[model samples]
Target: MTKTLGRRLFGFGSSGRSAARNPGGATTAADCLRLYDDAAAAGPVDAELAEAAAAVRQLPAADPGMTDALLALGGAALARDLPPLALAAADAVLTRRKGSRAAWHLRGRALEVAGDLAGAVEAFEGYLERTDAASAGAAEVTARIAVLREAHSWRQDVVGALDGTAPGVGALAAGPLPAFEAALGRHLDDRLAAAGPEEAAGLARVVGLHAERRRHQLLPPLADPLQGGTGRLRIGEFRNLVAGRSVCLVANSQTVGGGALGADIDAYDLVVRFTSFRIDPAATGERTDIHVTGHRGALNWDRRVTTRLVFSDRPEDWRQALRTRLVPGAQRFTGDDSLRRPLRTVGGLTPERWPAPLTCGFEMVWLLDFLDVSPRLDLIGFDFFATGHHRLAEAARIAGPSDYSSEKAWVMERAQHVTGPVIALR
Candidate 1:
């Protein structure tokens, strides 16, 4: 793969680099492109690719193949979980060719990963302007723009509430203001009618809270607000239950449906499943020892499941889930936002280099490792969307913006080196 990509990129034999080097042994465009291909063939975190990207960025804008190299480098950076570098490469291409639709699309994805939701929307709009509206690419971009716009609006509202800038937001800190809550509920209902499934869930949460007269919990607290006295198992208690037990994390990938591994899955000492997961006695097991979910969607699990973990980096997400989704008398737990990506602590990456929001399936795997699940941790239906099918079609829609490529790479690397609770991708 490396040789083929290198040859195609440089228009030379894989072993040939005659024109790639300059008279003074300085790097050339061909050299940088070849480096990029090599790095891409390597894993997601290749030092060579980083160095090549830096060298490519330094090349003169007017140099031959500079735009092509930058465009390719931008995509490679995104795949490698380096959003800032990807954004830089996209900007470089746009500077050279303002009408580059591919560059705009790349910029949109990079910005989204970097948490610049509004910037991402603008970049996607730019891409739309250059694309044929009737084309499939345009249709996909249109859907993406809608999702980003909704996310951006939600973020703005949450920020306003947090900073006490929105009208009546100041009253939230004091306690529930019935009048303000009623007004917000009406507003959310109007938006929910037009929202996509993902956004509608959040909007519905606010409306539900208002209806239930739990308006005071609509906004997230400034700190970890869950306590031991709240009918939740403490960290030690949760560890004691599953720390050394053989665990199986069943994802919603379609591959599991074909494996007929229901009995095999049930064989594990503890079975963990995600939100809205399906149960087929012949394909997916019916047991649910632990139910892990994100902020979105209503809880749907067997009543016998004792432990439920809500995973989200945003405080509002888990906070809302606790109020709206948690089943009464269930053992509740929430994931720490600091461990959401683990790029900074585990991979030695800066904030700019982290990937986009991960799926709950991947988060659960990481959480188990963090919680010291021992002996062996088996994974099923976790091909990272490689098969292009999910047990629930809505899940695919909800996870449309997640960075599955980078997550898959990270998991593969973890499986190789993780000692305790040795990962086994079944």
Candidate 2:
């Protein structure tokens, strides 16, 4: 198998969403050995990193330098117990070098050791996907996937929670009603009170999905049931920032076509993007003021971006980031507020729309209320990710058929809420 494919399944580099691997760098086996030794010996990490960095400069597509350097860096970091750095190095290598036979093994090892069994499974599966399935390590990777499946089976936990909750508002436009809120609240409260060590992982996943579903309709009772997106920023504080200003939020959409770098798109006073947000500078303009995301919940786009980033579904991944950390305008939003409104407001909407009623509808309302409520907002390249068959199938399973499409329709209907202007860059 080629090294490049191997790397894509597991490579890591730079930081944030825009970071990509340099395709030009090539490394030799000799460089790999020397760098690995120094990186492993390491009086300081920077010294070893510098050695690997220097080597990458000389690498070309034909040479083995890039792969070797990344391996060396990953190995050394693993030796030092820096799993994140190790994972990053592996990921960086895999991005531009997709054919590496060893990249798969490296990524799987890093993810597994880091407690991200789901990601490890995906990495191993990806390795198996590109390489000869009957190859020497294929059996072991298949075994790993089996183990990971046990964890993914936890998806049923959320389904059960949804089934248990009494249905409410059919239309998100009406917001969460009384009967709906009561049923959902009881369920979330039970989860919150019952979440223990053994069930921490399952509960966390349930909470994450549940809260997100609530957010699709409108901000849940600010309880942030899952504790995933909760940060220091408060609701009013978020709203005040953009209450009367011009703001722009960009989404990673295939429909951007050739307008990503268009001058009008770049002219927005502020720009917001999501996790592992990627764009070609020449194709997409170079302007990003804020990044709104909470790591790759189901995709290994970027390793444990938040301290809340959970690697292991076996353990809770919803811990809070340290107060002292510097993520630059990045924050979380685990719902945290008390709701006291007419129960009918929530109860009035029937479950006819959604038996469970939480679709990942346009989260802009939640954003407008809690994040940046810029009166004038432009949502660019914001297609509902409805292009591919795979996405369609996934959406069917996750959001139900009608809910996803309805969400798009709802967002389009609410365009007037955005300071009387709704620009569709598609």
Candidate 3:
């Protein structure tokens, strides 16, 4: 991939400064068009193209008003499949308007398509925080963050181009390709890891906090606000409503076979399932009394489910999606999943301050701790290890039992304290 990026990124017909210099910082709409046309036509005029690129780079530095035109040029470059150029254009815009949410989004999009996942994550983070908590496609951006966080978990096997070359982060721009860029990413990871917890956590806060920040609902305390304390008024009331009724937590594990125990699960007074996970009455029974999720992807099913919800991340957005579906008695989780935050911490994960981990099954089990119920907590479809027959394996294909070992140990050590009689169906 690094070789591909270099081969495609470099080799621009010999060199950028080969022939003549056109002098950069030309501020004009015509200059933008000329640059786009020159690059798109793929002529052998490296000097002309280089000069044009240099000129585009000067747009934001020259004057603040060029942001709009630079944005348009960046959009054009993206449409033409020139992601690097698009990034440059967006960077130019950011230089002038550092807090420009649109520019951050543009940079994030370009970096993602260009295979710079780390840069993409940073840019997207900047965008989310720059935008005032409410914007179009925020859900999609949130989902993208959830995925990129997962990608950052694994290390890349990188080798320099030269036989016996020492690995260094600086070599990313000058090394013999291979996984040079990915090596830069690893180097960044290593540097951050070595930077001590305080500095590391600061950067992490930038990435994680904005991704799935739980909007605190500090109205009136219901039931001590320290135990079984939830943000939604309906949820607090539901706890009183359900009182001592038994609640079941079901996951989409191979054990369930897509609703094979629908009847059994539905028998419980309250049934909770994860986000985007479907339940067929024919297979698992359709009693989605309460749904819990940490993904923004659940935004798509807003109108689909009239059942109550408990969100960890993007809770504010969920409020808008389920506005009509919500009733006065419905409950929500606005940053009150105290159980989830600690679970991620145990797994060596910040996970965006929500239950937005690779597999939320364990988090689901732990979720029972936060509910306002003392009923029997029967768990189904939870194969602590992924080495089981999952009825809906595809839903969790990208998700694996990566962190199950430690999480399992955590559960075993404290299962007895989980608010009710714990029973594992698998």
Error of 1 at 317 (Å): 3.0
The prediction achieving the highest lDDT against the true structure is 1
lDDT tens digits, residue span 333-365, model 1: 433333323333334455467665656677667
Clashing pairs in 3: 235-331, 254-389, 254-390, 254-391, 259-283, 259-284, 260-283, 262-284, 262-285
* Candidate 1 lDDT score relative to the true structure: 0.59
Quality of model 2 by C-alpha lDDT: 0.45
* Candidate 2 displacement at residue 190 in angstroms: 58
The candidate that wins on TM-score is 1
Candidate 2 local lDDT, 334-424, one digit each (tens): 2112110111112233446434333222343334423333656777655665442222122233323344665566567656543222353
Superposed on all Cα atoms, model 3 deviates from the true structure by an RMSD in Å of 22.9
Which sections of candidate 1 miss by over 4 Å? 1-230, 299-304, 330-353, 393-397, 416-426
Ranking under TM-score, best-scoring first?
Answer: 1, 3, 2
Backbone Cα, N, C clashes tallied per candidate: 0, 51, 9
Q: Say which prediction, candidate 1 or candidate 3, comes out ahead on lDDT.
A: 1
**Residue 104, model 2: Cα distance from true site in angstroms:** 52
TM-scores of all predicted structures: 0.41, 0.31, 0.34
